[model samples]
Target: MILVTGATGRIGSEAVRLLAGRDLPTRALVRDTSRVPKDGAWSGVEVAVGDFDRPHTLDQAMRGVGTLLLISPSVPGQEIAVIDSAVRQGVQHVVKITNHKATPDSPVDRRRDHARIEAHLRASGLRYTLLGPNLLMQNLFAVAPMIKQTHGFVMSAGEGRFGMVDARDVSASAAAVAAAPAGHVGRTYLLTGPELITYADVAAELTHALGQEIEYRRITPEQHREAMVQAGLPEPVAASNAQVFGLIAEGDAAWLSDDVASLTGTSPRGLRAFVTDHVDAFR
Candidate 1:
């Protein structure tokens, strides 16, 4: 059986759907089984309750599981311990969902955490695939209301290009790696969308999709942090979030790769398509 953590999340849910459709013996590790809504499409899958904060519960969830799709929880500092527990439970193969720019020496706190997990996986002698996904197109949800409310989008990216990929495509790549042979172990895939676009280009797409004159406004990092705080995010999260844009603005996010296409056997969806599909959110 393949065990999936964070089974109710975007990538995890998508992976579970794909695995379930293939009639693969899958176990979805959720915090609360009752919280997991009933999905007739996933009736063949099993539900297991496990929390990463409590590592003792992982054994039952990982029992008889040959491979694990370990979705890193959004909470910082929890992934390494959970991965260690999973390793001790005899998980032979692991597919980790890490950030796109997570290198062995990435300065980002989350990326450092992911690097530690990768090291643990290697030391444990388990087959592992590190999936480093770029920014999610779903982040467009944040600017959606700005477009709908003021017909404008705001960011601190300042023309920095991004290769954001759709969550579905990342899930597809994860599924492929999960089903593949042992060669993928110790390999890291930098998943990205088909096109490189800036926040201004994104605004143009939204303007076209919404039939409105949406404009992109560049802001300072402090201004962006203030905006995020105004939107109800905590101070540290807002600052950290804005800091990433600062990194991108400095040209850290401009690079592109063919990992997604090579893994999923298809080009990733573009920002324009994402904006068109999610235009309702903006409206």
Candidate 2:
């Protein structure tokens, strides 16, 4: 059995759907039972109430699970304990959904956090696969209100391009790795879309999809942080998000990889298709 943490989240939910569709034995670990979908593709999933912060719950969630699809929580130190629990429970394999920019010198705190977890997982003696997905196209929906109001959005990622991937594709890759862990063990896959795109390019795509001239306003990192804070994000999270954009502005995330297609047997979705698919969000 494969145990999926963060099952209610974007990637995890999609992973559950794909796994269930294949008739795989899957268990989803969610902190709140109400968040679990009651019908549709979620019907066959085994829901386990678990929280990474609570070690006892994690142990219970890992019971009879041979492999784990581990989605690290936003909190920095939370994943280490969950990894420990999975190890103690004899989970043979782990497919970790990690940050693409995870390194010791990463500017973003979340990236650094993921790097630490990756190190711990590597030394834990468990068979593992690490999936580092690039910037998600779905993140653009965070500024949907701004786009609808002014036909534009603001960001700090000046001119630099990102291989923006679809979250669904990431989940599909995770499910593939979970289903067959042998060849994927110890492999680190850097997943990306078919093309690299900048925010200005995204604006043009949105313009065509929404039938309106959308603008991309480049701002300073400080200005972006202030805007995110004003938009109700916590100060630390806003700062971290601004730093990620700063890294992108420095061309840190301006690369593409075929890992998504290689793993899931399908080409990753490009920006134009993503924009067209989510046109309603912009409208």
Candidate 3:
């Protein structure tokens, strides 16, 4: 059986859906039964109520699981705890979700944490595959209100290009790997969309899809941090957001790969399609 942590989350939920649809033995590792979705994708999937912080619960959840879909909140110890449990359970493989920019020296705390988890997973002696995806298009939803109100969005990444992928494609890739993990073990794939684009490109796509002119207002990193803080983000989180955005200006995300299509057998969606699919969020 494939046990999925963060089964209620965007990527994990979709992965579970795909696995269930394929008649794979699937179990969702949620913190409680109340968190289980009533969606049809969960029709025959087992529900294991457990918490990552609690090891005994994880051991119970892993009673007969073989493959693990490790999708956590990117917290420090959560994934490590799960990895330890997976080791004890003699799981055959793990499909971990990580960041494309993850590195030991990344300025972004989350990416650094992902790198740390990856290192630990690698040392755990378990067969593993890492899916490191670029910036997900769903991130734009955070600025939906601003776009609806002003016909524009604000960011610190002025003219920076990045391959922003759709979250569904990442989840689909994960499901594809988990369904037949032996073929993917020991591989690290950098998942990305088809093209490199800037926030200006995003705005143009939004304008064409919405039939209204949308603007992308560039701001200094400090200004972006201040704006985020004013919008109620914690000071440290706002600063971190600004820091990552600033990295885009340095072309940190101006890379592309065909890993998504290679895994899912279909091309990932582009910005124009993403904008059209989510235009209601902006409207």
TM-score of each: 0.93, 0.97, 0.96
| Residue-by-residue lDDT tens digits, candidate 3, 1-283 | 9999999988888888889999999999998777677656699999999999999999999989999999998886989999999999999899999988789998899899999999999999999999999898989999999999999999999998999999889899999999999899899998889999999998999899889999999999999999999999999889988999999998999999999999999999998888888889898
Task: State, as a TM-score between 0 and 1, how close model 3 is to the true structure.
Answer: 0.96
Task: Please count the clashing residue pairs in each candidate, in the order shown.
Answer: 0, 0, 0
**Cα lDDT of model 2 by residue, 99-142, tens digit:** 98788887678888898899999999999999999998889989
Model 1, position 276, has a per-residue lDDT of 74
Error of 1 at 141 (Å): 1.3
lDDT of 1 by residue, 20-75 (tens): 88788888999987756575756788998888888778878888888999895645
The TM-score leader among the candidates is 2
Best by lDDT: 3
Q: Indicate whether candidate 2 or candidate 3 has the larger TM-score.
A: 2
Q: Give the runs in model 3 whose Cα sits over 4 Å from its true position.
A: 32-34
Each candidate's root-mean-square deviation in Å? 1.8, 1.1, 1.4
